[model samples]
Target: MSPSSSHSPSPLNPSTHPWRFTWETLAHIPTLRLYLFRSPTPTALSGASASASLQTDRSLLFVSLTYQSGDVVRLEVPVPRVLIEPDEEVQCVVRSDHVEIKLSLVLPVDHPVVIQYRAAMGFSGDENSVPISLNDDLKSLSSGDVNLYCKSCSTKLTKEPLRHILQMPSLNWRDVAENWFGNCCCSFGAAAEPGFSFEILSGPMYKSAVPNVDSCNCHDNAEGPEEVAHTSDMHDLNHTTSNCIVSNDPDRSNRQNLYFGGGFVHNDTNISKDVEWVEFCCEKCSSPLGSYPYWKDRGNTGTIDGGVRLFKCYISTSTPVGGSDDVFRNYTVQNLFSNLLLESAEDEVSFRTVVRDLKSRKPMLQLVLLSSKAWYMSGTCIENHATGPDCQVELQPVVKVLFSDCSNSSEADIRLVENWSTKCHAEEVYMMTYEIEELKNSLSFGKQSMPLSCNLLQGMHLSWLNSHGF
Candidate 1:
């Protein structure tokens, strides 16, 4: 099908801005969504309207809109397959608001509709889908001793090469265990382990993977937390295990920290009481590197102590090369968080996430992933018209999300939080306050670039993050 009453062209003008564009292929039917934002003051572009057309081969699609003032907007985008030509086959819907135009495209079908739709929308098949995980540079340990330095100033933070590295489970490992094994701990032929329960805490709380203090002790003059088991046969555990870490020697404890998610953790004994946690900073630049808990909590396993968790984004690793250092590539906060959220979503089977401050455990941001496999094209109307005939639209991969800042949530948001908590539909992720602020700023900037009409969906604000290679 083609647009009705197609206009040839006049000198282009900036009457409308299609600030937000999305190409979707997840469903059996492929579709396109666009929002054209109009100015507050009606211009010669009054009575502005739009139309669409497709090339004969359907390799490219054209969109043109005309206003009462005779201004025109013309855009061309590439399609992966031929488009159905009959008017009835194509569905177009347009709605006008106080300051925007909403356009929805439902592509026509052919024999074996699903196949055609997916191909046309550029779904390259399952083999092209890349998996996201924790950053490999820090996740895996190389042969021999590895030294860690501050990414900003190259200030050495570790006294020696890390000897042994262990992986920590997710923050909600206990809940995951309970869900898989049920409330009864006898499933594995043993009672539930002490110092753990599936009950949700009453307010915001930071929970870490901590081992039993009494049983965990370092060997061979190494002051590190020892691995301990609650029972003999608890693989199919119904309760939680004390999977924590501890380190006493300040000189060598740095080599024994465990790596997990996006950070490294070290257990300490001299926790303070005035502040719940202390921010660990780089000695050279004073840049915040991580934090350790100061307050103590009583548990079934006795005084529960927290450990220092060092973020991977703020640090860099190096290996000795001919008595010199070979620094690894720098990482970003966005990439680190993206990997973490993507992995957690797949593991927890939920798209809704609550990012909290690791120290305070206060919810900082709430996000819902709408489409991990998405391509978006965003441009201003002025820029589109200014580009003239040779204008080329470049679609970039992005992870579309609906998000909201929880720093100042409303009653409705509170209710949403309660619902998520009660039903356990949202997974909690932790980061430093500064890192959370950085993520929030990135998302907010993306939202600002979009049209007012497309910046929000449902009650949450909409935004996108650059995909971690899909």
Candidate 2:
């Protein structure tokens, strides 16, 4: 239920709410912060003409403010899950101007040392939030007998269901493992060069050899018998190496291939041998799907040989048997970013990060995680009354963060980012241009709902990025 006040309208009548407020609590923080905003009236009371009362009983915290005009605004917050020490004093600060009335409160510590404020405020996790994981989503998609399509145009992208799905190893898996174990496990062994090896050699063995021809043609007037023999040996070695590389390539194997990892999906099928590179797009709509490598470099994580790497964001899935078509549940831009940030926090063991544009490599936003688990309830306060009193406003789970916009970064901003990168080891997160815009919108909306005092940390804006969604 929304916070209650004596003269405030019911939660069902949100349109007449007279106050704008935000109540927030972070994990492990023993204090609860509540900010209330009300427009100042012509006859508003102040000084000796105004007074406020704060008290806690059982599982509820009650607040009341009385004006000289004999009007009273009261708010009640339910804290059933958090034990409040009613004996302790509560700190309430009120600031008023011709424009608005601002009220702030800091509650004392409860019995539990650490707690999620949302839980205390009577919000159940199951009803309010859904956590999505990238790996889990891919696995679920692979298991379903569905056809993939372009999200924008609904053009069929796959001729058939993906049969074999594999996850690509992390780009810096070895380095991370070594740091933890103090030695490389050698899981993939010393075969770092997966498909082929190209070597450059200089000597008399190539002095008489002609360049730019398919075969190494040697001049008869060039060298002695020993030099000629060396040249012959080099040519054979190069030919044998090329043959071995072609045979060892896994993509050439007779397996229906589809692999996903690192926020990308690859499709390998029906490719002609002569087509060395391709820009994958929907044939009917010609919407850009993804691109294929001109040549494969197994050393680079992005280049999967014999396949096109499609961005998951640009594709959709349809399962005819399930009667679900054009479903965009887990694939929304906000959901993807939330999961990525959660995963990155765990993988990098750091809460600070810089979000950059995937194509331009420009810093879009810099984020410092304040709390992985935070809950907040914010809305306008109503004065006009309605009969129904049972309506409730649900709290949302969010990743509380302090962020800075870097699109038009100044010299100070640049230095601040460099400090986080070097001193804090803040990891870098890359996203598409559109995805960045969506994330920025979410952050700004969250910030506006917060109290002015809670909206800034140092020079960065404090905001919330929803951690869970359907």
Write down the TM-score for model 2.
0.53
> Distance (Å) between predicted and true CA of 372, model 2?
1.9
Candidate 1: regions farther than 4 A off: 1-46, 52-62, 74-94, 97-149, 152-275, 295-308, 317-331, 380-397, 410-416
Backbone clash numbers for all candidates listed: 4, 7
Model 2, position 245, has a per-residue lDDT of 14
**What are the per-residue Cα lDDT tens digits for candidate 1 across 1-470?**
22322332233533442333334333233444444443332222336676766553534456676656776656554443323334433333344421222223344222256435555566543222333333343244434565566666777755435543333334432333334334332222253222221111101112222112222222332432222212211111112233322233342222223222222221122212332444556767777665543323431222112233456556566633211243233244665566555666667667878876666666778888876556555554333433544334434446778888887778687677757755866766666667778899988876764545556786678887765442
Worst 10 residues of 1 by lDDT: 197-206
Question: Model 2 — which ten-residue stretch has the worst lDDT?
Answer: 200-209
lDDT of 2 by residue, 1-470 (tens): 32323443332333433456566666555555666654221122243122333434334344565554455555554332334444545666554311122222233222232224544564554333545444555455457564566766766654434433334333222222224322211112343212211110100000001111123222332221111111121212112322111122344322213222222211123232322333445666665554443323332232333234454545666633122443333344455565556766777667888886655566788888777777677765434332334334444567778888888888787777877777987777655455568788888787777545446778889887766632
Pairs of colliding residues, candidate 2:
5-74, 16-382, 17-381, 17-382, 18-381, 18-382, 19-381
Clashes of 1: 4
